[model samples]
Target: MEPVVLAAGTALVAAMASDAWEAARGALVDLWRKGKPEEAEAVGNELQRARTVALESRRTVDPDAEQALIGFWRMRLDHLLRERPDLARELRGVLEDDLVPTLGAGERDRATTLLGRAEAHDHARIYQAGRDQHIHGG
Candidate 1:
């Protein structure tokens, strides 16, 4: 779950480097509004600020600054998820349909696809991840 949020956050910020980021921004703001209706305008304003920093960091060739922006967005998304878990699937939709598609050819390489499934029956428990995973007392 954390990994999925991280991937989506990273992809959304990466989309900021694209000229088509407005569409992505709109999609995200719409999602935020759907989940927390009162925060729609605020989220749009915040995303705009993030976009500004992302573009500036790119122009200065400052990867660290862009990384900081990704971290910030990731935290924000995490909170949003905590507040409204139902939006999780819609968040993924925005990532795939809006954010990733906004990336340019060069930036597209930074995007990753993750698939995870956990199944359990009776006394069993399952933990799944797209990459690394750990099991205790299995």
Candidate 2:
């Protein structure tokens, strides 16, 4: 659930900076329409507002602002999923079928990809994970 919501939210924000924003917006609104027609209209409007801010963030090269927008949409998606757990598949559709392909090569990279770099010259250690990870040693 968390991964789907995270991917959808990331794709939502990424679409805002893409040339196919309108199409991506349509796909999102359509997804909402399936679960709740009334809320679909509101979602469309909200996407437009977010698009404005997202575009500004891109123009200024503000990663923080971009992350904020992603967080904003993630919350909304989380609530929707909580309300309708069955919508998970549809959410993935909106993410993979619509938003992802529209994104540029850089943005299309799966957000779950994690990279870590460590250099240990002596007796040293490093740890990294794409998600929940725990290390216990002495």
Candidate 3:
């Protein structure tokens, strides 16, 4: 391979790896907020390793597919990340402006259900965390 091509490939791989790490961290934080700290940490570690492998194979990996998968995970995180009312409102705005128009009746129903669950879980997790912190004085 040409040196210039190899350098570009390395740069692309680094970007991919960074994106993957961010996605994995978001996922782990989501899980931690949902009351599964151990599982979240495990998955986060695994994802970090996956990102390393993907970066090492950047020449062959499809960046588009990786992006699509990242989008999926990000959507999951957005739905579940309701700890901040401001963030939730912002996400809802995006959903209304972007996702709502694209969704049909069945899809809307599913989306609503999923959002409800995520919000409920987020609320509960926050409450528990606060309670724990109060009790522990930390």
Which model, 2 or 3, shows the larger TM-score? Answer: 2
Could you tell which candidate, 1 or 3, scores higher by lDDT? 1
Q: Could you give candidate 1's per-residue lDDT for residues 1-138 as a string of tens digits?
A: 475688778888898878888899999899988999899999999999998999899899999998898889889889899999999999888887888788776665565554244678999866656668777683
Which residue pairs of candidate 3 clash? none
lDDT of 3 by residue, 93-134 (tens): 434443433445554453444333224554354343312345
The lDDT per prediction is 0.83, 0.85, 0.43
* Clash-forming residue pairs, model 2: none
TM-score, predicted candidate 3 vs. hidden true structure: 0.32
| TM-score (all chains, Cα) for each model | 0.79, 0.79, 0.32
Q: In candidate 1, how many clashes are counted? A: 0
Per-structure clash totals for the candidates: 0, 0, 0
Instruction: Say which prediction, candidate 1 or candidate 2, comes out ahead on lDDT.
Output: 2
Which candidate gets the maximum lDDT versus the true structure? 2
